[model samples]
Target chain A: MILHSIGWDDILQATLATLAMLGGSLFFTVLLGLPLGILLFLTGRTQLLDQTFAYGLLSVVLNTIRSVPFIILLILLMPVTVLLTGTSLGVRGVIPPLVIGTAPFFARLVETALREVDRGVIEATQAMGGSVSQIVFRALLPEALPGLIASVTVTAVVLVDYTAMSGAIGGGGLGDLAIRYGYQRFKTDVMIVTVVLLILLVQILQAFGNRLVIHFTRK
Target chain B: MNSQPSQPIVSLRGVSKDFLVGGRAATALRDINLDIQRGEIFSIIGSSGAGKSTLVRLINLLERPTAGEIAFKGKPITLVKGEELRTIRRSIGMVFQHFNLLSAKTVAENVAFPLKLSGVRSSSVIAERVSKLLARVGLQDHVAKYPKQLSGGQKQRVGIARALALQPDVLLCDEATSALDPQTTRSVLKLLAEINRDLGITIVLITHEMDVVRQISHRVAVLDHGQIVEHGRVEDVFLHPSHSKTRELVHEAEPENDELNLGSIPRGQIYRLTFVGKRAHTPILGTVAREFGIDYVITGGRVGTIRDVPYAQLTISFTDGNVHGAIARLRASGVSAEHLNGANSEAPLKATAT
Candidate 1:
């Protein structure tokens, strides 16, 4: 009777909202993180476009953002989230904070991925008269594609975890569903189902990410 | 030989490169003066860390010199900026020791990279040029394959094709065959020689192997301790190395020379003879020994062609004989005879008969 009270419709709605939040935040995270990572790589010491001042500034900003705990970041960015999405309590509202929370983290992953590209390949491109932008587009990015895809997968999974945490502040998702009905109301069945679903989601994402990485990797 | 008044395609005048490593400035190249003539395979040979790599990088402006000037086609390269520098770079391509091909790209894409960078907007033209270039390097069937699928030799062929894509007037080979096995090195070097001959593209190659210099190079420059120790026609530099470093390279390339224990042989005048061009195939040595009545023992010898110019060297020992007549007779036949070891061991006589 208690499990029946929490109907399949509620689970379906929560699932859709969770997917929406995941999709939305992942999009913004990659969009912002990819360029930031490229900038970090280009302006890095001994890189093609090494700029000590810009590199220092970016490094500090990324470090500052990454140091803040996700739950605290959710509360801290409440005003900005509300300003951008007109509400700081649902899927739309949480998307901004989720991206902000994870973009810098994802960007560091991107920098690590790009760094794995061989210096010789870059130099060869330079020898061919490839401009900086051409080197990035034609060689650096392509060479790092598999690693970059792996980074995206890791970022997406992390965002999924962050999305569940945002549920503590009425950021609608499976986490909100479990906390509101499963924890507060003592519906162990609902909690078990949501936990199982989250596990399934992560497994699916990891498998997909691995497949994409293998497909792109030639070496 | 120097009668041709053609200007050098690439010239470095008083060039030097210094790097700041851990707060200490280290010199990679020092006041290097070099002239790469048009349509000649000029090789720079040196041991690792002897600034060979830095010297090649300086040609393409990949590593800017701390001082002096580089001229490409008689124009100062340092004065060029941005787009102009790129345009100049397009006309001069480079191949690396590691091949340095894009692992993500197919063979065709790898070869077409330079053309695409040069802003060749026509896909048809790019395809045609890429095909022709790959075919030139003997990789026409490998166009669809990724670099990971190709052999080391094939990868280098792709590298050569890529370097040739822009129809560059000059090609820089940075130890291009150093990573290859001997057989592969021969093939790659052959392809490079063919490219030079057919395309009339000036090739500037850097290698630690003297054989690579002897095999294909028209001229050679030997580097030691960040400086040019020797630079001249390959035949002159390789046959008679003036510097110890050059001698070491020559010895390393031709190891059989050291195996000749001329010191152990008693009572004989040892003469190392060189035969160039048509003389290499002639029976001059037999004729000289028979005419002079000297007992000539063939001690050590090697016969190989250098740059398609047939060449051979032999060490002959004359026992209990006045070898002056034989040496003079060998000289009279237009052969070069260098007297080594035995009675006149104190000073080696370099006598070339007209």
Candidate 2:
């Protein structure tokens, strides 16, 4: 509670940076991952539009990206991140690596969620003459809505952790404030504040996600 | 367009299904040649793993046959795909054992699914059709409720309504009543019978229960190990099941007929008397007993109708004189009598229909 190197203004700025990175990265993750997830599901074994080769290739690439640790991925993706976002530092630059790091993870979650939709329901839809797109959009997507929302919640929480890790390489956020002032400058107050904020963000996300899931779940 | 009522609504010629299980091709159905007559409730009864589900799914092209052809209203549908297959599917509805109602949608929306998928642009038209279908299935009151909110029977009613949405010529029920309680099963069967009678929809339902076949179906086919062992009119099949598998299935439905504790009875000649149609109501056994001066004790029996055709099967043992003469007289009076030799209760009952 004593006065420290970190000010309230610095705390506010870091919080804003964290929010911006989270929002930007989450949007791209879903926008890119949803279709990727659907593609993985559709081309999966025994599923509609099943293609063994395409599925195999996509599987390998996604697994490779997912297997790499986030900290290493940040360093590894620097040149690609700079190419995509013109720099590999700060909130703007950190988003590219964050999206790449989490999109496959989110896509896998989406595939699993879609898989949880009752096969009988999909068959019924197919029997009703539902085309592939119709089945996905009407039956599969709507049926898996709750699971998908939960997946997004999980991915968002994971993204929060990844954004913190992005601070290791000069990524501007609460994690940056904590590392610079709290650790390097020995400002324990800044570290505690950032950790609490991160925990609160995750709690809010999880609570909101649960409410949406409950609302949509007919079962 | 000429409508031929004599033409079979759906026909399967030498159809077979082969599934790859652990990289080995296993046949689910084989050499299935069947014709579902128009406006008839046709049932396929079999034990579990007898390919009953596969057979029904083939009719809807949900499971593509590995061999031969399936024709819907005289058109071969086995090889059709994409838009054409979907078009063919819209005219042939299917109900599943699990109900398969969309968990996300309300009853009304579920009923409207097929209609909407078929490009019915007007929401009012979809709503009107959905309500009418729900009313037909007696679920009009539960339109706003989700599938999870409804009971098992109500969920199936919604399934029935949804299947009827496109007014398909044929409705395939794959163990639709297998998941319901006895009372619920009866009501659902009644609803199916009503639907068949009023709408004249050719119903092809697959079930493991012979009782379901006897209650509603006009004709039946017994499937065992992917082969259709026996097929005929419900009454004929019930009264004189030719195939051993059919006999087993029929015996399960009439367990009392074969479960007689023959060891407890005194030494006597046992004869199984089958009374068909008008003879089923006549007191043939009593009259024969009185005339021949023979006392006969009924060991076991069941009197029931096979889709409106009354029939009776009674196991009786003669206690006194003229057992042969009484059997002859019973046969003379149109009852088929089989003299069951020995007291081996496990022996299969042989039918000697006159």
Candidate 3:
């Protein structure tokens, strides 16, 4: 437990690292995964942008990445991470791998959520002479907002896991701190702090997501 | 009834629709030739799978036909596309059985949809049109409510308002009130009749209910197996249903005719005496009874009007007599009469027969 009292500066640094990784990875994941998810959904056989080719491609890529473990995904994207961030270690280097590791998984969840939107609503919008883009932006997106929120929550929670795991690849975060101080040095207090932070984040994301979903869906 | 001949507003010739089904083709309509006149309420009715819905949708061009021509007011529009199709569609409004109101939109917004689609910029104009249309449909107060908040009839009223938002020349109803309860259906039907009468918008409706057809339609087309089996003015169709499908669909018994007081008359010798035209007012039964010294057993009948022309049917029986002189006297006076009862069918008056 000495690592717990090992200086407020070190603990603060680890906490900042975790926050940076989590926030940065979340922004990147949403930016990348959202469009990927929309593509997967819209390109599906029955969707607004329906096309067999795009759906098949998205299906293959998502399944391929998902089949490989997150650790392997991070390792596979190591070179791309270095080229983008100009580093292969510490918090600065972690964002690219973290996004690559989480985006496909997040995208798949989003696709499922978008698919849950009613086709009837889409048809009604079309009957009203709404163009393809208008129907997408107004009808499909609005109708599927609640489910999308729930999927975003799930993605955010999964992102927390990805952020934590990113620490192992020579990256600085709560996970890295825990591994460096808590595991390697047997610092029980450090482990407890990291674990507690994760629980709190999960709680906040879950609560917010559930509330947003209810807010949109309730008549 | 106005005797003026209205212009034909919607005309389709040799229009056929076919769908691809698992490497095969299925025909929904085959060379459907029809003309719907202005200011007339037309009804197309048939059993399920008769392609009535498909036929109705053709006017708005929801589904383009695989072959042939559709002309609306002399302009051939079977090949309309993109902006042209939208412009064409704006002049023709359609309602559905499900009352397809956007669940997310308020009644006002739903009514404003067609206007919005037509690129109407002024809210004042849209609001004025919506209010006028809603007032016509008797749904003026329901403008703020969403579809889920309203009953089926109220939802349909909103639908009618929405369809009229563009002030289309033709209104197509695809089984509009088929989803409503009987009472609600009646009220909605009455409202549609009022719309047709007030706005003078030509309406072409599709329904499975003959009562709905009878309620508002000036003329009806009976569809079966993707073909029009019968078509004519509703009164003519009712009076003489020529086609087998028409006979099946025209309905033999009507609720208005149920006021017949059928139980009062003895069943010994019953006859259905029908008088066509002005004779419905004349007391011819009394003349037959007095002229032949015979008591006439009046059974079932009521004062009724058909196609704005009054007509009456009376179920009567020969109360007591050889009934020969009464039959002769009734037939001679331009009053059509018959010997009563199916049970005593073999008996006939010698004077009438010879």
Candidate 4:
């Protein structure tokens, strides 16, 4: 009551801003993550496309980045955030950091997805005289599609959580409003509403992700 | 020097493979040399880990030998690489222990994969080729189904069609029927034999079963510890295995003394009977038993064929024992006989293998 009741316009703008940050970050991540995942999968030990040094180094680097906590990554990537998007303060600034955080995670997920495909299939392709490229496109990618979708769904959920968290640091989303109106002004209602909104977003994301994965898998 | 200038379809010389384990090298093959004539079913048989798979893989360049040379069609393919190597591989089809068909692809796509690799243009052409291959294999209705939806034998038919897609000059099979049951294995092998006969595609296969080797292979090689110990025509090998190591064991105990003991030929004046070529099916055993004027007890007898010519071996004992002249009379019948046991002895005489 102290900071006044929530305005209808604020909720709409906040949701839109959250969507922009999460959607834009996910797009960039998938773009970079898919190829990176393929590289990791193909180059690993015992893989059809084996490369000892390359696979080893990439795996180490991915694990290293993933080990860092998201909050710390956001702070640490401040300069990169500014350089990429011209500001380290708003939703645009938060995107680069969000992508860096999530891309490695998604890439690892995708690598697992690609690896889960039957090795017999790859050999069959080779016995058929398939080149490395053909095997990747026709055999590996198509076979891993369902698992890839599931990974994407999981990644989207993680991004949604990051989006909410980004609001706490002034990225202009529902979280930012809750921080500005609820925590600062001690208004329990603002905090409660933002919490409800996040929970609702999570439910929608999980449901949609499940639907997409099911569609791709035809199950 | 006057031999025909016909090209050998598959040749291996001093081919050896060594794998490092625990900082020591283990040789999988040693100084193996062979020449397989074109359009023949050549089989390599040995106990497991006999380097048969390794040797077959070398033909398609799936594995580079640790030492020595492999040539296909009179060309040394040792240095072939990149696109050239791929093109060479395209002309050779290979099947594996597990059928190795892509579970995700339908039968048509799996069969068409090699053609696509050969850079076949136009889906229509690919489709026509697939239909023709499937029809040949008797799987015309299963073309649209995935490998998981098919039986083991059907999956192998798809594998065969894929291998034959480019109409490759040579086909390699590495235990292709090992994963299948006996009946399915026979049918798949028969299908391979037909492909060899009808299309004249040379086949190189590896197996552990002597029966399989006898069924269709023209030439057979026996490998032990990465070395070719015995190699000859299937008929010769089956009739008289030259090596003590050639005796197949019921189980792996020791390779040194594993005699096949084709059942003990009867003891007590036992005569080792030898029948070759036409003598196999002529009821010679009954005739000899009655005519020899000696009581005969058959302890060992078998009906088999060498070179599609039926034959039998019998170890029979003569009652009242054998007079020296009775042996002379049997020898007069154009039969090779040897005393198995000492005069009325418990063990049959060992005949010298022909």
**Fraction of native Cα contacts reproduced by each candidate:** 0.77, 0.86, 0.16, 0.40
Candidate 2, superposed: residue stretches over 4 Å from native: B1-5, B257-270, B288-295, B317-334, B338-354
Writing each residue's lDDT as its tens digit, candidate 1 over B248-341 gives: 9888878755524656665477778888889999998788777778886777877788888988888887885558998898878888888777
* lDDT (10s digit) by residue, model 3, range A1-219: 544355568767877887788788888888999888878888887576679997898789878878889888788888888899899888778888878878898888878877776664565555556666666676666667788788878888887787788778888877787787778888778788778877887899899999988877723
List the candidates ranked by lDDT, beginning with the highest.
Answer: 2, 1, 4, 3
Q: Please, what are the lDDT tens digits per residue for candidate 3 over residues B1-354?
A: 235565579988898999877868999998888888998999998988999999987887777889889989889988877677777777787788887676767888888876776678799998898888888888888888878889888988888888777777888899988899999988988877887888899999999888787667898888889888777777666544567777577544353333234565554556656665777778887776876778766656645555345667666767687577776776776655655345554442222210
Error of 2 at B75 (Å): 1.0
Model 4 alpha-carbon drift over 4 Å, by segment:
A1-4, A186-193, A207-219, B1-5, B249-278, B288-295, B304-311, B318-354
Q: In candidate 1, which residue pairs get closer than 3 Å at backbone N, Cα or C atoms, i.e. clash?
A: B331-B353
Chain A vs. native, model 4, TM-score: 0.93
lDDT of candidate 4 over A1-219, digit per residue (tens): 553687868877988888888789899989989999999999987787789999989988989889998888888999898888889887798998888899999999999999888777787677666788988998788888889988988998899888777877767887887888779987778888887887888789889888876665621
lDDT winner between candidates 1 and 4 = 1
Question: Against the true structure, what is model 1's DockQ?
Answer: 0.82
* DockQ head-to-head 1 vs 4, winner: 1
Superposition error at B35 for model 3 (Å):
1.5
Q: Report candidate 1's fraction of native contacts.
A: 0.77
Clashing pairs in 3: B260-B300, B260-B301, B269-B340, B269-B341, B270-B340, B270-B341, B271-B340
Interface RMS deviation of candidate 1: 0.7
Local distance difference test values of all predictions, in order:
0.89, 0.90, 0.77, 0.79
lDDT per residue, candidate 4, B220-302, as tens digits?
A: 88888889988777765665566655656211222222122425533356566677776665665566556655676666555
